[model samples]
Target: MKRSETFTTVLTEAHAGSRIDLVLSQVFPEISRNQIQNLIKAKKVLMNGKVPKPRDIVEGGEEVSLEIEIDEGVSAPEPQAIALDILYEDDDLLIVNKSAGMVVHPGAGNPNNTLMNALLYHYPPLKDLERAGIVHRLDKETSGALVIAKNEETAEALQKQFAERTVTRVYQALLVGELISGRTVDAFIGRNPYNRKKMMITEYDEELEENPGKEAITHIRVLERFREHTLVECHLETGRTHQIRVHMQHINLPIVGDPDYGSRLKIPRKFTHHAENVLRGFRRQALHAYQVGFIHPKTGEDVLATAPLPKDMTTLIDAIREDHELYVKDHF
Candidate 1:
């Protein structure tokens, strides 16, 4: 279903001297800045009776008009009975522990057997909400806790928390190398011009003509160490595509089994046959969204949920630990 609505607002003194997109975004918090920019681009937004640029400066007392076409309802994908590992649920939202290899939503090649389809089948009412009430996403190969809003009010509230950087997200990852200490990786990440499928630290990559990237911050601390690998925790400050993986690679400790950002495969000599096989056979990035915490939109209370490590990651860790113990017994 498609429905168009027009809104008009007059700028106040406090809103003066701000970018048009910024002004409109604050005026209508429900509409995202990106959506506001698109409205300006499509000639659906007018400032003081003139179609203004998204970057145009706004003065006080100017009339801003915006027309938005809301698309929802029938556009939702069909429900499928795919199973989900739910961690928490309430009237407002639910936390799902998404398994590795399950796509979050219907996209391009993945049209069925997605978390969205599963949510719709499980809840049914989710079909009426946008993107089946999904407020965030994890990579297709990333297994972890994810939030799904049950209504528009909850969706907007949760989105605001994420936009304001209040929602807490922590990941557990196994890296290919041992990190000596915990550090924060603050870098600008953007699409690789050379490889569109991969993300790169654009600000640090001198070859890029210009940086079309956003700042990404990840605080990593070692949880356990092995002869050739490190289990670490990652706290995300900004949600960027491939933020953890790219940042790890930037620090020369790429996550194990990450096909894109991982370094060349090298099995350490200290590993036993089982350990070597485990390290070599792992196929997806050793990253999991271990926990997510946010305020309940409906109950006004803090909510936190944790997901257990998957079987593959736990098994791999066990093998590496055993090998490390033997290496330490002989060499140390």
Candidate 2:
């Protein structure tokens, strides 16, 4: 059987005068506004102890409540026989290497067959915790090492580590442009005005409907450089939505194959035929979270996990390397 979990919050001056949907989105950044609206439609959300429409305006100090239905066993997201690439595991936590194209949670369009489903199957006990004991997430197109806490106490401890910005997250990204050196980008990231589905680096404007952007900082280091592409390693100091993609695009070095932030495909004249084919075939961002580290909640020892590059990315890099060598040899 399932149980209902209730979450309640009060709007502050910072969120004053915002639409209810927008206010709820800011309060629960993990869930999308569309999902919040869906909850409202299901009569699972209340404002000031009354059901409110999504467009209702909110003033500071108003109480809002959201209810979510979850099970003590495999519930709405029925457990499936999906295999997880286990990286490290203990009684307190489990680290898995999540493949690209795998959704971490169920949402509007994706209601099942997600990592959450697989986790429930792997360890049914996770069904009792929020988000199946998952404390963090990776985008569907971003492959990476992810950590999952196993119990309520451990979940709280893990969440505190992430909130304090103590968790170490490292990624490898293939960019569309070349870089002579590494750089650190400190910018504000907010929803794109023209495209609500995308994020961008922008300044806050009082007149615009957009909420004030959050600070995002990424430290980039060039690892290898091709004629038209650069492979770089990024360390995140603050984890904002699409932080790397937005920061890279802001620097005019959008990631290769990033559908939203990438530029139009421009094959270099000197690129070999194979390189062009690989670049054209890629449909997802060339981004991978290679490593993650945190202090274990129970053991009180540091834990680090690393994921190897996926085959597609490895193949892409190989094609680029061959093209670079051929170009250099032909010119010199």
Write down the RMSD of all candidates, one decimal each: 5.2, 5.3
- For all candidates in order, the CA lDDT equals 0.86, 0.88
Each prediction's TM-score versus the true structure: 0.82, 0.81
Q: lDDT of candidate 2?
A: 0.88
**How much is 42 displaced in model 2, in angstroms?**
16
Q: Can you write out model 1's per-residue Cα lDDT over 238-328, one digit (the tens) per residue?
A: 8877899999999999999999999888889756999989988999999999999999988889999999999999999999999999999
**Per-residue C-alpha lDDT of model 2 across residues 144-261, encoded as one tens digit per residue:** 8999999988987877677567999999999998999999999988777688889888776788555456668999999999999999999999788899999999999999999888
Clash count in backbone of candidate 2: 0
Q: Please report the TM-score between candidate 2 and the true structure.
A: 0.81
Model 1: CA > 4 A from native: 1-76, 204-211
Error of 2 at 76 (Å): 1.5
Q: Which ten residues in a row have the lowest lDDT in candidate 1?
A: 203-212
lDDT of 1: 0.86
The prediction achieving the highest TM-score against the true structure is 1
